[model samples]
Target chain A: MDVGIKIIDSRGAACPGPITDLARAYRNSKVGDIFEMWATDKGVKADTQAWATKTGNEILETREDPDKIVIRIKINKR
Target chain B: MKKVLIIGGGGGGLILANHLDTNEFDVTIVDKSDLHFYQPWFLYIAFKGSKRKISRPIGELVRPGVNFVKDEITEINLDERKAYGSRKVVYNYDYIAIATGTSPDPDSIPGLRQIYDEYGDYHSNVYNSQKLWSHVKNFKGGTIAIGQASPTCKCPPSLLEGAFLLEERLRGMGMSVGTSDPLSPSNENDPTKTGEKGKSRIVFFTPFPRAYSAEPMNKVVEPMVKERGIEVMPFFDVDTIDVQNKTINSLEGDSLKYDLPIIVPPCKGPKIKFTPETVQDEERFIKADKNFMKIPGYDDAFAIGDCNTLPTSKTGVTAHLEAMTVSELIQGKYSEFNGRINCPFDTAYGKATFVIADYNNPVVPYPPTATKHFMKMSMARIYWMTLMGTADPIFERFFNITKPEKLNRKYSVPE
Candidate 1:
């Protein structure tokens, strides 16, 4: 079955908020599920990357806008 | 003279208002509370039961020329450069600086608000700190859960500081305490193994996988924590508190039993309203340029301290530096802030370390020493001098030694 991308909007949340939101969503998500997170906290950039790297997830892309940051990740592990 | 309206008479607002050239600008400060608090003292108030010298009247702190208005700022119309206060007063300003820092949101977590309401916490205010002291002062031995409920909080090191100090206080009270490594996983209730039956066990929790978010700082702190027998529960972001059961739950599917819970409540920006709503972010923190501290599209408008989205830790030191930088910027003396962080870490037993860093350099913990501890303690007493700019010469000299360039060179750490 094809899985749809889950959007986790964590804008205005600070460090760990975005990461935690992603982790929470990832835990309930099925394998092969894709996730996109939006955050305003600058720490989200490094945190999302580190969290993905540690959790064995693949970063599909990371887009940075003037006001917010968006990260796309594919779950590779439980 | 140009009228400058400063909302919130906090460390950043007071410092900026005091340092600004009174000859060139007419400054007025508006705050809900008439008192200025030395917030760093909250830790002492919690752990040490200190009740003196932590606050001063905001009126006394403001310089001779600065007008102090005791009213809550309800709205800020940046386009019109007007601010509305709770007293139904509207003030116009040529330039406006918002230093209204973040406020602790007790209700952010489930059951957490009631927990603090009943038992109190040091993070909230003087009353809460005192109430926390009363709750924990007579504690002999039990499970003391000290950690953060929020992902972001002011003074990141305060969690560890409280743990170390509380552990020390327990030991000083002649109680045997042993640490349980939550990183080890198995949640077997072996009180005999962890020494929880007849002794005090401090379980320090953090959302990060490591004891501290910063790796190098973690390296320095983890050892001290382990040495002091403080149990660490990493990756445990507080999800909720079961007050009846006396249990703390984490978002990561872990729960721990506790006798006394002293979790740092979540924080959010002030309740002040902005007309366009774009002035603040989702969490309501004012968005401003990292270098200039100026709100976008408005050259004369700025936000500093916990109120501004500076991408740094919410700390008084960050606020102080930004205040100084913005004060100078208003005078046409532009200096870019290097995201300097100078947080004093008290590791208990009269030893402390200064976690000094900036955007350019990583935090290299200075070897814990009594001198640093003393300096940290002394600053609490002389903090008023800093707000008044009376200690500028000495403070600037001290800051000079801890500058990012100096720290980078001294520690020889890569950027």
Candidate 2:
């Protein structure tokens, strides 16, 4: 079964704000679920990637549009 | 007897030096420059006719017992626990406190120094009140753009103060005020050129999306900017300056031209070579434990003030509080240092100001108000008096003494 978690894209929320919100949403999710984060900041791509790598999660896919970007991460079921 | 050596004789260094007991430890303060500036007042000094009142000789601020050295520190040899100076003197320390506050590097931007050289002789880089007053008195008004080049820049309110005070001073000089579209090049190529000859327009640009990144303050400042008719352009990094044209190009493809531009260049730690482990974060700012103010892996080395990567605003007040905490730790009287820092700011009549950060939490966050006006003024007086050796004992006691429970609470934050 595939579960989709949508994080309202916090594109321009400034430093630490978007990161904090993403962490909160990720924490509330179950193992093996896909968390989708929408962010508008160019810095968020590297930030979210770093966050995933540090947490041992895997990025399933990332798609970017002009104004916003959507990132999908697969949580490790540790 | 443990010897405490403090580098940089600015607000943070001086506060730490004063808080330490002279008899117990031999404290030596070293700074490269001969003059110690009341830096916060540079804004007012630039425009007001009272520059002399704001700056005092560095010698006046040192306590009777402290040894002051006038020399530039070239390097900090942490492995050997020594600092070398241009005077060829090497001072070793039982405890070292780093408080060399931030310095602007104008060289980082193209054409910045040239523009500054041509147009800024009347401005104070540190404290040029005469220059500020001269610029204000010259009176022809055009677009005034204030921009911060880096995220770690000191004192955002200073830029706000410049905008407000310039407006007030220009109006008093019989110049009219006008509003232009936000000064982004994408919106219009020439915002300042479109203005009338005698009218002054002001535009403020920040790299961040909001006026102030910190909450509540941002909320307050955003509306205040709107109310004051100051154009706010957020999230645009400055790419370069066209010195010939007096225009600034943004990384986001926006440009702004100004008649007089007061730029706050990016600030960085003092030029010091340190091992990766000795410094913290991407910036080479000396790293200290969040609570104890101790450099990790080194017992005797510590950092306080803007030189360190403290989470709080890089103001004198934060340094003073951290100095008290670090002094206690150095004397072995306290096992740990703990305190919360809250930077309180005020915006009055479109001019913004800040007061001593009230660390007593839950933080009482408020915008600049009437009461804060007196607080800011009195605090400036306290700073001046302390530096001048004339502060009453009561002010010293209030800042130095801390309750045990508060200390314990602060240490609870994980490093």
Candidate 3:
């Protein structure tokens, strides 16, 4: 069974801090799991896209509302 | 065994020396000064009073087998493959790397040095801190003008950083010097209102049309400057400095007065002789193929860092990336010379922005993209760690991308 992890909303953090935290959390989780990150920093959208491209991770979805960014990632069990 | 001699101990010289393999080529580094400074942190040190803990003894940065020489290089006899230094030592090398960085030439402007010496309190940065600190404390709201004498200046953001932080500090002290008239009447009369001495009103001026000529940065810096309420007078070249009058004469028949003036002087490469064949440009900057970093005609001699006249900004990050490319070319790893190199820059908000350069075509091109700020920050850590004699695993892997033989092919000296 795959595990689902969530990063409870990072609203006002600076660049790379939120992304770094999310990356660190994802690294500790088991392969083939799902990670969801909520952020308010608009740069996170580009950051997540770049992270996925560099790391070869799968991005399930990225949703943007007025105040926050919701992103979901599926880790490939390699 | 190949002998590589590197001149200058700044960011470029040190990193290239650190990156070379110990088993293959013997490296010798010659530098005039013993101290290795983390210059990027100098601005932070001046404003925030934060000391950078990143420096190390110059000796520690060199690889174990590499020879370190402390002397100023007097001349380079490129024809004979020998270099002479002030210590009366003649060193011969199979290859030479020039990384000597630029220095401020205050002497170029008449009366500028005298003014600087007399009004030392106005400009406070890494070079002159004690005077700068005292001046800042005693500043009592007058027109503060920051200007650059020439182009090709390093850390253009330093002036902006100082202005912004000074404004914030002054405001915190209840001295509200707005952007319009930094030395408002209220600021001059009330010494206590200015933090320590009631210094108010600051104005920033640059000779360039834009804050930074480089793109992406140019896009962001102007907004930040205006946001900080710093007045920028573009294209105002200085003709002379009238120290007695506390005024500056501009080439365009304009005169600007200042209570305090911080001037960034013009920068130039050190006086060194290169064989006419070696340097194609009149300026004597080493002429190298943009793609391979190889000196035209001379296979053994290569130039890196500020010493060479590369088209890109003369920053440490650019030097590091170029060194990697040059190393790969020297190692004969042509296959890996995929005509692309990553140039990373630090943004206004302290984020690491980068562009990819493709050098194969006639027109060198760069794409607009930025990496995670962590990656940029981590690279800085990697540089510090490597300089401190600890090879991080991540950087080591990154360095291994291009084989050594590919690097050697592009830089072979003629027999």
Q: Best lDDT goes to which candidate?
A: 1
Score residue A42 of candidate 3 by CA lDDT. 47
lDDT of 2 by residue, B26-102 (tens): 99999887677777666666655554465566676887888888888878788888888886788889888888887
Comparing 2 with 3 on DockQ, the higher-scoring candidate is 2
Residue B32 lDDT (model 1): 93
Report the C-alpha lDDT of model 1 over B1-415, residue by residue, as the tens digit.
Answer: 9998999999999999999889899999999999999888888888889868677899999889989999989899998989998668999999899999998888877898888887787777888888888877788667889888866578887878888888778777766676443423343435655435446778888777667766666667788877766888876777789988999987656798888889888777878889778888766789888777999888989999988877567888889999999889888886877777888889899989877766545566467889999999999878999999998999889988777567646654454
lDDT of 2 by residue, A5-69 (tens): 65545543332234544554453466777777776545567666766665568888889977668
The TM-score ranking, best first, is: 1, 2, 3
Mind giving the per-residue lDDT tens digits that candidate 3 earns over B197-276? 44455566555444543223345446655664566665455668998888887543457777777676655666776655
When summed lDDT is taken over every stretch of 10 residues in candidate 3 chain A, the lowest stretch is A12-21
lDDT of 2 at B350: 35
Candidate 1 stretches greater than 4 Å from native: A1-78, B179-198, B412-415
Output the lDDT of residue B339, model 3: 30
Give the fraction of true interface contacts kept by model 3. 0.00
Docking class of 2: incorrect
